[model samples]
Target: MESIVMLSGNVKYTITLDPSVWIFDDRRQDLHTYFHEQQEEKDTLEEYTKEVSKHWDREIIEGAVVPPTLKTEKKYLKEELLTGTFCIPFKPFLTNAEVSENAKNLVIETVDGMVTIPLTVAEKMVLGFSKDGKPLREDGPIHCYYGDGSNYENPIKNVVSFKIE
Candidate 1:
């Protein structure tokens, strides 16, 4: 099917990925901003401590106020889903397929040709399924991108399947 990509080869399970539903996934990333933006890593422990301290202080001062308005949150999310460009990490689907321990490479089957990369690196790949608020049906069920955004402009197109070797 145009919306599915099969993940097979040296794996415990053969899985089918449907990019069409990824728009609803919480983990989907904005494709437009992903390549242009630089993210700063924060200390996880410190961030957690600060958030907990803030929550404790708020609860102590206000005695457990009602939660934030879901109506507003839902509105914003709905707008984004309708107009925002998006992508999802390829790693999750690949991990779900459970690559066999002996597998060392990931061979991407594209419309152009087969492109091979070390499985270690492929594990971090991001898949661009939509662009400019539209599914990339012309050349994709997905376009494979290097995790670091190196090939964002020229992503591997027409991803038919992923073969682990």
Candidate 2:
């Protein structure tokens, strides 16, 4: 089952899993902490400014001091499906029996959390698993596209092509 897959958009290309290839450290920080901290700081600053303004005769600057905008940081895991050593294309159809047998091995970790590879990719890689359920191959060229999740003018334009080798 040798096939070629191509993709575009946000993607990372790596032939194999190398510890050096991991861009982020394995530290999981609470995403909400940063936001809450910023909010608290902003509130404290506003209160202090208001108190200080009362002592001055001039109308203190109003609304000019903007709290730092809280931007969500993208969390990178130790293993990400797109960043993993293996690349599998999306498969749309599988029989009940095939799904039952292969679905267990299709789960992959993403930045958003765990996601399963499409049925077709799972089927192709069914025989590629090892005794411990890990893939035997260390390198696979798979293309993936992380779309914006918006409706595209031509939906197929975002289609990724991959070949099973």
Candidate 3:
């Protein structure tokens, strides 16, 4: 019953048949810390995604919501695109915002002719509100004069006020 074995070229070897089966003992201690950090990052990203989703949903809801059967043709529907009563495509503008380098200012004429303001991020609430300082209808379009933030040539300059009609 020899405890050591000798093999070719005078090499000696020792073998532990049971090999401690606890290889993951050290890693298990830090598992919880790793998981906690991952959860924190995940939660932060989820909050960011939710905020982005809110704006995305608003654009989608504001755009044309026509039923599937009401379409005259197979045109691609865009949440960021608006269709006027004349079937004209009108793009929106964020207040004092320039979406792209080529975006220009635009005008919005409401059907009621009650309110007209610049379409901007800061003015969203103003347009969203009713004349009596009450809440405006969320489903309908709030008319305004918008600068599309494009057209570098003129860029809708010298335009300060907008008309309701």
Model 2 agreement with the true structure over 3-94: per-residue lDDT tens digits: 22232112233122222222232221122132233221136578779878764523354354433431222233323422333222123222
Q: State every prediction's TM-score relative to the real structure.
A: 0.79, 0.17, 0.18
Q: What local lDDT score does residue 69 receive in model 2, on the 0 to 100 scale?
A: 38
* Candidate 1 residue-wise lDDT, 106-131, digit = tens: 99998888999998789778888887
- In order, what is each prediction's RMSD in angstroms? 3.4, 18.0, 32.4
Predicted candidate 3, C-alpha RMSD? 32.4
For model 2, the stretches where C-alpha displacement exceeds 4 angstroms are 1-105, 122-165
Q: How many Å off is the CA of 165 in candidate 2?
A: 19
| Model 2 quality (TM-score) | 0.17
2 versus 3: better TM-score goes to: 3
Pitting candidate 1 against candidate 2, the one with the higher TM-score is: 1
